[model samples]
Target: MRNLFFILFILIFVSCKEDVLPKPKAYLSLKYPAKSYKKLHFERPYVFDVEKNATVKDSKNNWLTIKYPNLKATIDITYRPIKNNLKELLIESEKLVFKHTVKAEQIVSNDFINESEKVFGSIYEITGNAASQIQFHATDSTEHFIKGALYFYTQPNYDSILPAVDFVKKDIVRIMETLRWKD
Candidate 1:
């Protein structure tokens, strides 16, 4: 009877231990964390700076900033047609990542023009364990570009901090989807 009690207690304790750990949240939909982001109107009308810090310049000379506090993130949007310096612009963007990240894991590049009569751009996303996505959008011969990156600390042994990374990535996606170059 004592052995049976001990076994039952051990089973209960092990089962209870699993409940302490939280489940990882999957990236679903475009909505970002509200508390950590802010919206600021820019000169380009519908195109706004959804960021904080408001200082770091990206590959295309657009100022980057944090949209909300506690979210260590940035969005750098530069609007110009790709007539000249297209090659130079791409090179500069490449440097921005290679200088910091060890390597690029996954990259998805695409050209798009939204319905808002705004921009057409080649979006580049460089993903790693701690990845950054650089989206370059251009319209006409000139390069109307919005290049942004999201970064977070890589996970340690038993714990993963990539949740924060995933959260910020959602914010980047939200900004990209809503981007519009106004008249």
Candidate 2:
């Protein structure tokens, strides 16, 4: 009886698991393609550079959807001719960005200015589980205004998709850098 009691005590102590808390969520690690860019060929109100691997869906209203098939992601571009609504357009763009504030851990903005090229804009990087990880708006402040948002086809898992967001964020910068408003 004593031997059996000792074995039971040992089993109880030895098999005790440190509280089996659920495992922390894990993110994916991925490989990306080499980077190269080409000028967008479609005739439009503006011209910019895009990743050679991406396919663009053009709309009659001058909006564009830059699709990355492998990543199952897209960068949607919206175009507006700046007649007299620059302020309104700017506000609207910011409003669209802030729509994610409820879910975003934080939103960061980086201003892009190329006075020589007449391209001025801000790129917003939203952290956490926001629907859009990156967004931007660029303009000549007179003739053209363009806003872009990044989205993934799958659910928004910010950490898992961060590398993809970063990959496209650089492309958006390239777009802002190479932007030229058509006359």
Candidate 3:
């Protein structure tokens, strides 16, 4: 009976012995291919280089969406004729960008001027958990005005979507640099 008790106690003690270890840290890694751009000649008043990875869909009335299916994001482009409303359009565009200031950490504005091409505007890069990461307006300062905003389909989790945001930002910059107003 003593030997049986000793065996039972040994088994219980051995079974109770467990190694307490901390879990290893984990991180997400995403990889995207180098972007190849193609000149997109829209029937509207402008032309720009679009990444081949994206598909462009006409929304209506010269408005279009450049969709990145893999990234679940889009660049919404809106075109407007500058009648007597250049002031109004500029005000509206700036207002649209500032609307996210509540959630944005900082809004950086970059002036884009192509005097030879007659395109001039500002690109706003909003950092933080804002609904839109990038917003831009391009105009001939006389006749044509175009604005664009980059948005993700998912909820605005800045940390989680930083990679995709950066990828799209480069594309937006390329578009701004290459944009030409049609005659």
Which prediction has the highest TM-score against the true structure?
3
Question: Model 2 over residues 1-183: C-alpha lDDT tens digits?
Answer: 999999999999999868778999776668888889999989998999999999999887899999999999999999999999999999999999999999999999999999998889999999989888999999999999999999999989897788888888889889989998889
Please, what is the TM-score per model? Answer: 0.51, 0.84, 0.87
Candidate 3 C-alpha lDDT tens digits along 1-52:
9999999999998998788789898787889989899988467678899999
Candidate closer to the true structure by TM-score (higher is better), 2 or 3: 3
Predictions ranked by TM-score, top down?
3, 2, 1
Instruction: Kindly report which residue stretches of model 1 are placed more than 4 angstroms away from their true locations once superposed.
Output: 1-39, 44-46, 49-62, 76-83, 94-102, 115-118, 130-143, 153-159
Candidate 3 wrongly placed segments (more than 4 Å): 1-21
User: Model 2, clash count?
Assistant: 0
Tens digits of per-residue lDDT, candidate 1, 5-58, equal: 999999988878554667888763444435344555434434643544333343
Report RMSD for candidate 1: 7.9
Give the local distance difference test score of model 2: 0.93
* Candidate 2: stretches off by over 4 Å: 1-29
The whole-model C-alpha lDDT of candidate 1 against the native structure comes to 0.52
